[model samples]
Target: MSEPIRVCVTGAAGQIAYSLLYMIANGDVFGREQKVILTLLDIEPMMGVLEGVVMELSDCAFTLLTQVIPTADPAVAFKDVSVAFLVGAMPRRQGMERKDLLSANVKIFKVQGEALNTYAKKDVKVLVVGNPANTNALICSHYAPTIPKENFTAMTRLDQNRARAQIAQRVGTDISNVQNIIIWGNHSATQFPDVANGTANGKAITDLVDTSYLQSEFIETVQKRGAAVIAARKMSSAMSAAKAAADHVRDWWLGTTGTFVSMGVLSDGSYNIPKDIVFSFPVEIQNKQWKIVQGLNIDEFARGKLDITTKELLEEKEEAMAICNAN
Candidate 1:
């Protein structure tokens, strides 16, 4: 067998981690043929919880899992890591200001960026799943000058998947038939789920669904799905979010030759999005890096919603920059 791939996941004590670890161990992300060495990283206070998670992994006896290492040290956890999933963050409390949240996460990602630069594999691909994920990914990518900017991405596949499921339900078709749904701009409430270019079993989505319904109801549902989940479950989305994270990385590392997914990445001026903002776009993975799918015509409606979501991303970037400058 080839040498095992090293994968590091931060925030191993959290709910998403709880859902993600078993999946990773069972080869749900990397495939059964690829042996994996797993590193679980968390704060000192959560070390015990991480150990418990490790114990559970041990019980599974996963043949593809070579070893499991739990650590509180970034350098140790990220050492030689091929894939880094940054999931830990200071979540926004009921009244927490954007500045406060940004400042706190900046410190966390800065240290992680430095550690990644120093210890991860030369080709390490990072996916930030924390809240304000796009901005937090920008912080890490900006700080890690050694890592190619294209190697850093934030999770928007969740939004894309959610859009696909919603469209499938409305069309009374299996989700397998839904294709080309694009989630534009950001991962938050302002995210634009564009079905203008999407299709259900090769039929244009716009032809099947009312354009107004797609623009208003469908878009809003995809954008606010996270909040809706939280409201209903009384907890942040964990299982589905974990699955999305896995799918994002799996498609990235494994390649998306004929498929497209959404990822929040440093913009290259696609769709007139301001450069350097980590915004979601339709992308395909090749050679373990995301290349934004360009030249898609954006209609007036799609363009308007894209602008709205991109503006939200830009504002978040500004908030992060302000906090960094203030400190």
Candidate 2:
């Protein structure tokens, strides 16, 4: 058996972490054979709550959970960690502009990024799960010069999963039958959930569903699913978000076999997306690395959609960069 690995999760007392910890502890993420030592971090006010969480973890009797360390200090939380889930960020409140929330999280992620650079393992993989996640991840990557740009990613798998489910439902097929559904650009409402190249049971999704609905209703539903969930549940998605995060890391560790999944990684000018900003694209996992799927025929309709979402990401990048420069 391989040695137990340390996994650090920020916002340990929050709803997402509440669901996330158990998944990792039960080997839902690291597989049944690999053991893990969980390093949990939150602010001082949340530490008491975090301790309760630790107690619950201890009570679970998970054979794969070798240790659970709760701390308020970033340095302590991050020390020698292999996989760091930067899941903690300030949520946007009523009457607040998106830029206002971005500024607050910029400072928080900058500090955490510095901590990761100072204390984490050389090849630590960072996944930003908080709101404004793509920008927060870009800020974190900017601050941590030592960590490779490719190692920093934001969670768009949630959007991808939602898109896949929506497509499957529209076509009256099993969810597993939908493949290669792409979520391009940001995690917000502007995101384009494209099924142009997707398949349902080895057939093109466009052939299965009406083109008009695919362009209009399907796109809107997948993009706004989070808000719809909050409207119905009075709370944001937690369990599904946790599951997507786990699947993302799992696919990155294992391989995706040329299957298309969405990940927001710092772009290298692929698909006409500018560099230094993290953007979601149709990607395949191989050799423990993700590469953008190339040579897709983007028709005029897809181009127009990509332009809108790309513009939003560019504006968000400017806001995050302005905050970083000012600080």
- CA lDDT of each candidate? 0.89, 0.90
Candidate 1 C-alpha error for residue 54, in Å = 0.6
**Per-residue lDDT of model 1, residues 1-327, tens digit only:** 667999999998899999988888788888778899999999999998888898989998989899999999999999999999999988999899888888899999989999999999878989999988999999988678898988889999899999999999999999999998988888888888888778998899999999788978898899899999999999988999999999999888788867678999899887788999999999988877678898899888778888888878888889888776676
lDDT of 1: 0.89
- 1-327: candidate 2 lDDT, tens digit per residue: 579999999999999999999999998887899899999999999989999999999999999999999999999999999898888999999999988999999889999999999999979989999989888899999988998889999999999999888887777889988899888999898888988889998899988899889999888889889999999999999999999999888888777975888999998998888888889888888877888899998889988988998899899999889889999
Separately for all candidates shown, the number of backbone clashes (residues 3 or more apart, or on different chains) is 0, 0
Largest lDDT belongs to which candidate? 2
Q: How many angstroms is residue 118 displaced in model 2 relative to the true structure, after the best TM-score fit?
A: 0.6
**Model 1 residue 232 lDDT?**
100
